[model samples]
Target: MITTTMSASERFELSSYRIPGSDSCFYIPEFITEGEEAYLIRKVAPGFRPALGPSIYERLQIRDSPVQRWKQLANRRLQLWGGELTSNNVLVAQPMPSFVETYPDIINRLQQTGVFHGSPHGKPNHIIMSLVPSTDPSQTRADDSPGTKFVPCLLCVVDIFLTVEVCVCVRVRSMSQAKTVPPRSSSTPSMSNRQLQPHEDGPAYHPAVATISLNSHCVFHYYRYTLPESHGGRSIDPTPVLSLLLEPRSVVISTDSLYSNRLHSYVPPFQARLGMPDQRARRIHEIKEDRFTAGGAADFVSPIANWERVTDAATREVLANGGALTRGTRYSLTCRDVGKVAQLKSFVKR
Candidate 1:
């Protein structure tokens, strides 16, 4: 057997910061300064989107959402950046825009942290961001669902093996679209559940998954089990292995065994509760009143479910002082690289 020999740090890049209660998870708070965050939003907002056409822009304004047009997939809606990537997963071989390379210095620092050190391109060439609102149905938008199954599509190009459409970037929205807390009995879609799926970044791209959460906080749960019998894998209990508290402005990266060895998913209806153990609570409601209103919605609440803790001492230190994990809305940005462009082209043409 060819034993994979490498330092523990080499496997997960966990040395960049204190381990977050798990050997695989790393959390960095304030990864981007407020100013830089504002700048990024300004640059990517609808006003500055790459030109699809005046008609598309007009339609976008009328629709009141960035995803006015595009094919919606089972997981989440998609808007291809840097021109449509080839089906084989390689970009058109064009340089990413200057703005992409110009993301805040912290992003550059992320590169130095060695998170993407082993990727084919040594850096992410594509970006996928999602804006999901709270409140079901009313939460309906154009985003596609990734569905519940993992279908492996493989093709070989030259000497390179490729897998198509593995999720590279999966960002969850982070703010309360409601802006104010409604009656607890009131219903609203609050969490972007797909953002929390336990699926792997897959074999097509770098194993590392860089996720950033904005606006609110939510619990991300992970499970471990043998690949299903039909897939001919072993048997193991799919028990809760870990759960992460994704806070606004926080950055989390996971890879190596965490990427390939487990399944993860987020419990929906995210909220901010206080006065309870995060590991033993569930957030079954959304914050509908002003997030700061007294006695209304605290920044943190007891999530109603039993979550396996994955936070570190440092992360807990920072979270303890916040205004409860306020139940504002949220958005997640997952950056990844998927391989399989050459084969994708053939399918596209046919």
Candidate 2:
């Protein structure tokens, strides 16, 4: 039986964009149009409003509805759709947001790609939304001082945990800030909002993973997977096996051994510039790329496996200049065919 809403031409074969020498990792640039990308951003961000009088409504809704709308974390904030799991790791069963399934219709298109062909339900029933903030709130920028103008780039994730059977991401943002300003600096040398930690989805779920970048461009790293500490696996080597440039509106899917055997992370604002002789950035995100770089000389483009695939001249030039691009807030939608789910009634009886 056929289960996809999109036609064949609209669906892409995953193998065509496979990374060289990799088993099942694929990258498709500009998977969604700019207009479509804008639409998705408006839905996830707190500042968006279709009407003027209700400006405060969305901010309040997000702030107040922590259990349903957004969950605050020590490192970041995220939303959960479908349902949260029980202590046993079984999902409670909730429907995904209508906007995610319709309008842009992300779920249906993903189904068409055959990315979830053999899962329990043959489609994702749960979605994990993640937000990784790129900037520290204490840092003051020229545009962010009292009464200054600051417009943030809504879809950039510098330290994002993007994983799932089918992962779709937007941007991770903390405070709203403009893209035009340089990295916010209070100290002569800046530290990252957080360290970049390389990891997988872990025991929470099992399956292939896919991601779509909604806004901004940055380098994503994949490393040889290390067994967990509990398993006495070797401690993670911060050096990357491969680095790929993730552009806005692009899609990357990892299946089979690639999803399970590799650890992935995005470059941070500071780490990308840490060792440059003239650069002042001291620390950014987690992990290291010291294997291929010498004193972190600006070779961002050369280290990435898909650097040549980048189409924009300005972006290409910036990567070559040893300067990291603006990693605005980024959001992600990770879909998985949860193993077990129970209705509210079923749970009540338990």
Most accurate candidate by lDDT:
2
TM-score of 2: 0.67
Score candidate 2 by lDDT: 0.57
Taking all chains together, the TM-score of candidate 1 against the true structure is 0.54
Compared with the true structure, what per-residue lDDT tens digits does model 2 show for residues 136-176? 34322233333444444323222223321211111212335
Clashes of each: 61, 18
lDDT of 1 at 144: 26
lDDT of candidate 2 at residue 220, scale 0 to 100: 72
Report the Cα RMSD per candidate: 14.7, 10.6
* Residue 62, candidate 1: C-alpha displacement in angstroms: 15
Model 1 segments beyond 4 Å from truth? 1-18, 47-76, 82-97, 105-107, 135-197, 226-239, 268-329, 339-350
**Model 2, 284: alpha-carbon shift in Å?**
15
Predictions in order: lDDT: 0.45, 0.57
RMSD of 1: 14.7
